[model samples]
Target: MTTLIRYRDDAPQQALESSTDGAVIIERLAALGVGFERWSTSRSPLPAAASADAILAAYAAEIARLREQGGYTTADVVRLTPDHPEREALRGKFIEEHTHSEDEVRFFVEGGGAFYLHIGDSVYQLLCERGDLLRVPANARHWFDMGPRPRFTAIRLFTDPAGWVGHFTGDGLSARFPRYGEPYAGA
Candidate 1:
């Protein structure tokens, strides 16, 4: 159940719009010059299932393609898995809404997550499952909820190799966007 929510940057108490429809999501994101797409795996050479050479080849091709299309130079995959004692605490206290100063992009390599983007008068609630990718533009103003830091993993992609250096919320507005549930597995 991937969703998209849009709203004013200063408010997160409620979404201006939200939906699970992929086409609608894509359309909304594309309007902001952001990219959102869903891909499926046939259990072949799609990185996770690939061997050393296969992985290298797949990335090489992707690098070339993205570089030509988006002036991308590198492709890096970073994974986050939390087993912290305060994982639940962090998740519970995780609703402090904020936004990246640049494009926020994530690809669910294994598990899933929630990406809530604040657009003008709307908050796009994106419930990203495995194989789903989301790109929220820089300064898009949003927050992420992984459900109290549950045992979830994801592969993140970024144009900036440093990755995920977010500007924390000082306004404390994350309380507004709609929360997420388990993604749709049979859709």
Candidate 2:
């Protein structure tokens, strides 16, 4: 299930609002200039690929539509498992609050993670599982946590050739917030 936790940016441990409903997640995110969509995995067949090129080729049609609609120029696949040695480094890098010049779009092909978007005075914690497609608008302050036991396959869409370039806010607020895989119910 997708979850949404709303809290004051300064008080991450105390949630002002929370929900596990999909419609509510979409509605809340949309109101904040973010886009959320749940795709049917059965409708889009994703073949196992050994290379990024093959992965992109397998989902060419879907990638094409998203690229055209969002004006994105590049598409790629990122897969990380529990045994990945770089899991900690990856988690640490993204756990810092940051913003990108181009919109950050990700479609979860498998597994799950959490996206913490700091907009206005509230932080929106989004737990995205398989089939979840989340688009964070350009320059939106956010951070992602893939959990300690990372396990996910995502298709990332980018507008720039440089791909993802984050401008870290160095606010250190992410440390106070809940990380992925934690018990977020009623948070």
Candidate 3:
């Protein structure tokens, strides 16, 4: 199930709000200018381990619609398993707070991942499972955690042809928050 947890940026020890309801999550994120939705994953015949081209082809219609809506020019698939050779390094890179030149959008095709968005005085931690689509607006201060033993496949949409290029914020705020596999449910 998808989960959304909101915490005060200055006090990550407690959650101000947490919900697993889709409508509530959508409303909360939408109010903050973030786009959230649940897409139907039934049409894709491709498996989670399918090649990027195959995955992209399976979701061409949805991708095309998103491209038309967000002016996105390219789309791709990123898959990572626990045995990935650079799992630690990749996880480390993603756990650092950063911003992109264009909006960061992703649709989880398999497994799940967490995104922590630092906006104003709140930190919204969103767990995106299969069929969940999240779009963090451009320049949003955030970091992603795919868990210590990562396993997921996601479709990413990009407006910039250059693709994902993170501009590190060097805030070290992420270090204070619980990571993907940690005990954050109580918060």
Top lDDT prediction, candidate number: 3
Candidate 1: residue 75 Cα off by (Å): 3.5
In candidate 2, stretches whose alpha carbon ends up further than 4 angstroms from where it belongs are: 43-58, 185-187
In order of appearance, the predictions have TM-scores of 0.69, 0.91, 0.94
Q: What are the Cα lDDT values of the candidates?
A: 0.59, 0.86, 0.89
* Model 1 poorest 10 in a row by lDDT: 178-187
What are the RMSD figures for all models against the true structure? 5.1, 2.0, 1.5
State how far residue 44 of model 2 sits from its true place (Å).
7.3
lDDT of 3 by residue, 1-187 (tens): 8999999898877788799999999999999999999989896546655889988887888899999999999888889898999999989887999999899999988889899999999999998898999999999999999988888899999988575799999999898887886766454
Which rank order by lDDT, best down to worst? 3, 2, 1
Worst 10 residues of 3 by lDDT: 178-187
Best by TM-score: 3
What lDDT score is found at residue 141 in candidate 3? Answer: 97
List candidate 3 segments past 4 Å from native: 185-187
Q: By the TM-score metric, which is better: model 1 or model 2?
A: 2
C-alpha displacement of 171 in model 3, angstroms?
0.8
